[model samples]
Target: MRIIKAAVLVAAGAMLSWTPARADTVPEFRGNDTGGIIAYELAHRVDARQLAVDHCASYGKVAKFLAVDAQYGGYVSFACRWVPYGASNQPLRTLY
Candidate 1:
């Protein structure tokens, strides 16, 4: 029947036009030797900080928090600085 064929076409069109929703829950790091920025959701702040620390560690430095922006989900700015004497390059871990 023409009605059935029209219904099928409409369904197919809708299916073709469907788009999946996107939530940026993953932390993204962008930095260089001097400093870097991390974009992430609030729930992923810890992950972002850890990523910064790891990146700075690669350069034999430590990560220092500079600023935070809550717009566009969230962002954390950090600078890589030399590790002072008697200071550990590793981030402090809490045992729960």
Candidate 2:
């Protein structure tokens, strides 16, 4: 009975120490200027969008989402379009 208890304790400790591998949550960008593709999980779409916006902003442009592909995971394709001057520069109002 004592040996069985020891085995159970060891198994519990081992189980507690084990950790599952984590998925890559960081967004990855590819391409330049005119357009680009972003690779990321659906769970992290907001981060991916922000990345795209930042990338386009460097080119003095805005990110225009083109498509979302779920094949082989997820991807967001976007274009860097120029934002016209005198356009509404107000902070985005969210209904949330």
Candidate 3:
């Protein structure tokens, strides 16, 4: 019985984590940025820090990824063409 209860709880927790959470408020950034958001969402599933550092300019060039189209869920997100949120609010605007 205990094992079954634990499994049920675990399954519920997993489902909750997978459930998508929309933002309650949107930012004022009006740009057609989609690369970062797309990459972030995809990158999030797997641990690809090294790939992000080498491929993602925002990760290395900028410092933070300004999420223009961010999706909320069990975690926070950032997806922008050029906005700094990491590395103490610094960005690599020159790349974009």
Candidate maximizing lDDT:
1
- Supply the global lDDT for candidate 3: 0.43
Regions more than 4 Å wrong, model 3 = 25-96
List clash counts for every candidate, in order: 0, 0, 7
> Which residues of candidate 1, in runs, are more than 4 Å off?
1-27, 42-46, 86-96
TM-score of 2: 0.53
Error of 1 at 92 (Å): 10
Which clashing pairs does model 1 show? none
The residue pairs in collision within model 2 are: none
Model 2 residue 96 lDDT? Answer: 19
The residue-by-residue lDDT of candidate 2 on 19-86, one tens digit each, is 65456655466869897887756426557667777778777788889998877667789998888779
* Clash count (model 3, backbone only): 7
Q: Report the lDDT tens digits of candidate 1 across residue range 6-34.
A: 99999998997796556544547678988
Better of 2 and 3 by TM-score: 2
Predict model 2's lDDT versus the native: 0.74
| Model 1, C-alpha of 42: deviation from truth (Å) | 8.2
